[model samples]
Target: MNVHTAARIVPLHENDPRSQDPVLEELVDFVGYRPNALLTMARKPGVVPALLKLLGVTLRGDGLLTEPLRFLVAAEAARGARCRYTTTHLVHAAHHLGIGWDKLAALPSYLDDPRYTGQERKALAIATAGGTLPVREPAQAIGQARQVFTEEEVVEIVSCVAMVGWFNRWNGLMGSVLEPVPSEALAHVPWLKNLEV
Candidate 1:
C-alpha cells in the first residue's frame, strides 16, 4: 500500500461533457480538488470503480448517518489514530459540509458539550469510543440515535466509523503526507489551527 507519488497520476476520464451528470461532475471535482492517497489508489485499474461503488452505497443508502456525521467520523478516526493526512482531508471535507472546526475540535468532549444534541453526542461517542474500545455498550447510545434516525441510519453511523478506521489504518501505515487544503477553505476554519493532529 505504498502511496503513489507519480508526477502525472492518471485517473478515470470524465464521460462525454454533453452527457455530464451532476453527481459525476461533483465526484470529479472532489477528486481534482483533493488529490490524496485514496484518489491515487483509485487511479489503479479495477480499484476506482469499486471505491466509487462503496461511496455510492454509503451516500445513496437509507442510513441514519448524516453527511456531516459521516465526514466527522472519518475526521475523528484519522485524528484519534494520528493519521495527519487523513485527518486534515476529512476535516476539510467536514468543513465543506458546514460542520465547523470548533465543533469537530470539541468532539472528544461531546458527551458533556451543550452544543451537541443528545443524538449527536451518542453518535460521536459511539464513533470515538468504538474505534478504541473493543466492547461497545451501544444499546443505550443506539436507542438515543433511534430517536433521530432510522435503523438503517444507525447502521450507516457504524459503517462510517468502520470506514474511517479502515482508511486511518491504511493511511497511517503508509505514512501519507499531509496536503494543505486550499488556503481559502482553510481560512474559514480557524479552529483547525488548534487541532493537534
Candidate 2:
C-alpha cells in the first residue's frame, strides 16, 4: 500500500464514505484534484467538511473586504504564521484572481512597496499584526485600519486572517504535503519555503 503522503494518519480513498462530500467535489473541480490537505483532514470525519463550509462563507460570501483584498489578507496571515503549506495554496488562489507572481512576491515587503496601494498597505499591516502568533501590539495596525475602513471591513480583515489561522496551524502541525496543483504553481517564491527544523 502507498504510504500517507501527509498527515499523521492515512487519508481516505475516493470510495471512502467521508470522502464523498459535495464540498470536497467542488474543491476538486476548482483545483483540478482533491487536495491532500483536505483529504487528510477528511480522515478526521468532520473537519474538512466543516472547514469548507466556513471557507465558503468567509472567503466567498459577500463581505466588506474586496475579493482581492481577502486573498491578500489570507496570504499575509499565512506568511506571518510561516506556514509554507498554506502560503503555497494561496499562491494558486491568487493566480485565479488574476493577481500576478510579482505582486505576490511583493508580499515580503508589502508594507513599503509601490505595487500595493494605500488601502492595500493598510490591510496588509493589519494582517501582519493580527496574524502574529503571540498577538503582538495590534492596536496601531488595527487603529490605522479603522481610520480607512469601516468597523465591518476591519472585522472582515481580521476574520479572514483568523480563518486562515486554522489552515496555518493545521497544515503546519500536520506537515501537510504541498499538493501537486500548488507544488507546480509554486513558481520561485523563496520566502514560502519552510525552514528545515
**What are the lDDT figures for the candidates, one per model?**
0.59, 0.77
Model 2 lDDT per residue over 85-112, tens place: 7877876787667787788877889878
Relative to the true structure, candidate 2 reaches a TM of: 0.90
Maximum-lDDT candidate: 2
**Model 1 CA deviation exceeding 4 Å by range:** 1-25, 59-64, 133-144, 182-197
The residue pairs that clash in candidate 2, if any, are none
Q: Which ten residues in a row have the lowest lDDT in candidate 1?
A: 11-20
| Candidate 1 total steric clashes | 2
Instruction: Please give the range of 10 consecutive residues that has the lowest summed lDDT in model 2.
Output: 1-10
True lDDT of residue 64, candidate 2: 74
